[model samples]
Target: MPLGPPVPERAQRLLAQLERYGSREHGQLAVGRRLLAEHPDLPLDGFMISSSMCPEPGRPLHSLILRVGEHDTDGITAWARALATEPIIDGARHQLDTILDDIGIWASATISEADYDMDQAVFIPSGDDVSFTHRGLLVTEFGEDGDLLFSGHPPAREVLAATSAYYRDTCGQRLRAFDGRDLADSITRGWCRFVAYPTRTDWRIRSASQDTPGALPVTWMYAQEGDTQDLGDPVHCPACGRSSRGLDYDHVTGQRVHLCPSPVCRHQWPVDDAPDLEATEHRQDQRAALAAH
Candidate 1:
């Protein structure tokens, strides 16, 4: 068989590491550090060894076996050099775009609820729009008129547009019209508050809170700001009128309900039932301000 392109320097180093450490066992972090130090230009993130995984774990270099199309270590090493030298950032971006593309294709073709549920396999009606929670990463929304509101995050807006354009320009499929700022205020604010990033394993963007490393806070923060602001505040329970800090926000549904800090009261009601005076007053002030303007 004819020889292929020379193994890339980065892959060559990984091959060397695999030889020294063996492919089955975890290599020293120092090995990865040395590899990284050697190639300062390579992106610190997004390098890939295959479609579903990357070379970031123990014996990550051996992961090249997925790409090299061979089981033998020698063959894998020989082929790793020929792997594309594209920056891992590009790979990450490409994967993101691909996810957006999948979402766009599904949303564009989906006319009825059945159609939407067919491919995405997940849909939930939230407020005025319907959220297509496909794979729980790319949540595409549609308006009442069945228009594509938005998909993915702000950072990937361009990629989303390009995918929509591709459907329009190439496939002649007129994707539902989308607005640049169609994301719900809650989603927008939550996205702004949290950070999301993709991994080589998949295009899922892991979300972490702005203040700490965790999921985004419940949507109640966007529901009626003032009340949710003091997540921990003593308040009179609507059911028992007892003052307690038992109010807790459900992370999944984003609903705030009093847990009744006072064991005697044991009152539980949605935040709607026990509107905070401060929030009500704030809303009144806002209304007055708008009226004045």
Candidate 2:
């Protein structure tokens, strides 16, 4: 195979920069620092840089894999276009346009419940043993025979919105969508439980069995906001005697309930029965005031 055309002076500078600071651990941060100094007005959340081994073996390819956040996509697209005009190899020039196309797709792409056929679609959540390579939620779907149907790490915002819509419309209940980072934390904390629910279910949550190949975590089951439920005082689990700090859906009763976080207990009770932490604090303050008098 041909070694390709000579690299342009501009490409040489970029290649030198990549050599100096393009490692996975520090690449984005280094580029971000440069951008901040040079193009302070440009909006950027994060970016990635990767290069392939050339056909010659042991040599870096002329083309680079560059991906930027949506906020900086337009600016990066323009920059890539300008860079493409340099006297670089054909493959490098082609890669510039490919990068732009990828950015466009990422900007418009979304994972919606409507994208899948409800009759055959099932949502699979990340398991406790599963590790994440990125910050976003990884959505995976599998067929009945344990065949991979679809998988994508869609934007966390899109994933949350799609999940909320799916449960609200299909399950006949609106579930509070927790942040992807928080959900990941819940998994690490061992607060998540997986349950397989058929896309056509009538509000019945079923445990995953041999027949059910797909399963998704109930976000409400692991994390809860204080305002979402009214707990009159800090309620303790009857079984574990630990303060209830999360809400879980009781599939048997079809009601939201306060959940005990104890790994051994895993007990749940009615949400209405949960005591308000703020009220408990207020009452304690009153008792302390009387004692002071």
Candidate 3:
């Protein structure tokens, strides 16, 4: 049986094609390029590294992979290192603290080396493997995959169980596990990241933390309210086509916050360079359409 959720048709077809490359003369080269072309939802906007060392040298490997969309990667790196050195319970709390609001999909796995090899061989373009260790708790980057954005593959059921044990040793608990065979599963489940209120009951994917509420919805919180802080020009929201003369512009953060007047499209976001909101929204629509299939 296929592991985890069913791989999307397009991804499954591409994966089959990628598998063929494993036997080609180049031997798994260009898999990442091909995958990115076929699936743009990858690099997952943002994610956190859930690291676990190999429990059994020969069996499948497991790790926690949380989809923390668009959070600063450097921040996560610093936090992961710091948590690794802290006491076990503290480390666990630290992980939750960093990602509780941003996290979308909480998936752990125990995937066969062969399966991971298949995904990595195609996804990782090239790089020397780097291992991260803190206080003897070992965590490593997923692979030499070309694009680090979507680096690791989800673990199989068995790999997840083994990984839970490893995570328990390293961080004090095992996350709810899923059996994801390829990157397609990751993309499918990742749709929740964009949703306002995500529900895990309908799918195999589960929340990483006990908190049932979804991540903070995207919004433009007012920074300053006085006339000095107000933007002079009538700015319009590209997403909703609403126009307003007064908007909050924070000099300290170097950000201009705008909230759409449209009730149906109460879109809020910061404007730094007069972002092409229409274009961005179009692209997101395209991605959602693709995922629906």
Candidate 4:
């Protein structure tokens, strides 16, 4: 018996294909990838979402996996924070404070198709992972294999309330408890995280904190990566990973901020640059300019 809301037409077709997997769970892997590809919509334009799904019909469990991008987190937090101060928000004020506590790992909000504006102020992430500990509650969560984790019950608002305090106090640290258990223990413990949604096979999770430790406060650190000087062309847009004459050159930095030619992308290059590259250029430019002098 497939559970949760009516499976989307696309999903139903995909599931049919996997029905024969040992004749029970056929399209589990494809479903997992689709989960990442088909994410729910957020309120704003600058948000992105990805997810993975695992099905264990034998155990009667279906888990939907989601990974929030950094920008979406920031947008949600900012919206939540603005809503906090308004009257009659009923704990919205508190929710904003909690979101601010660990803005990176615990900043999030969900609106039920209402035009209500928020007095709370949450600063959403632009270049990081999902903010808020559980900003991830599903409006309707379901596994491709036909399992339901949460939806329309206890309402997303209530779950936020239950987790608000714990996340609010953590301060840039993430508190992951699955199926009502601590995250670390879930990873190390017996089948707990797996049970959070009623699951059975191939469930794994990794935290952003693990990758970058020793962070400061109010959100430890932004992700940093080394650049390849072989960026090909410095004048091309660093954003779409494309290079074209259509770029915005920073007068101050003399660096290119490429704009995507595609109307859909409309993305601008990131302001950050390689400190190493800058230094190298500065030295080389000095020698050339000195020779000219």
* Reference-based lDDT, residue 140, model 1: 31
Model 4 Cα lDDT, one tens digit per residue, 191-279: 11111101112121212232233211121111111111222334554556555433343433545444465676756664456433564
lDDT string for model 2 (107-178, tens) is: 111122343233343434443322221234442222232111112434445544544443344444444423
**Runs off by more than 4 Å, candidate 1:** 1-12, 19-293
Give me the displacement of residue 168 in model 1, in angstroms: 34
**Model 1: residue 44 alpha-carbon error in angstroms:** 16
Candidate 3 residue-pair clash tally = 14
| lDDT tens per residue, model 1, 1-293 | 11134555665555555445432243332333343455444332212222223433432222221222212223322222323222123211221111111111000010232222222322222332323332333333222322332333444444345434534444454332111123233233332121111212222222345564333332211111112123234567777776754445433344456566676777666767554555456556656798999
* Cα error of candidate 2 at position 174, Å: 41
Better of 1 and 4 by TM-score: 1
lDDT of 2 at 99: 28
RMSD in Å for candidate 2, one decimal? 17.9
- Candidate 3 ranges beyond 4 A from true positions: 1-130, 134-137, 142-267, 277-284, 287-293
- By how many angstroms RMSD does model 1 differ from the true structure? 19.2
TM-score, each model?
Answer: 0.20, 0.20, 0.15, 0.16
Kindly list the per-residue Cα lDDT of model 3 for residues 35-68, writing each as its tens digit.
2344444332222233235444432222223333
Task: Indicate the worst ten consecutive residues by lDDT in candidate 4.
Answer: 189-198
The per-residue C-alpha lDDT of model 3 at residue 289 equals 93
True lDDT of residue 210, candidate 3 = 24
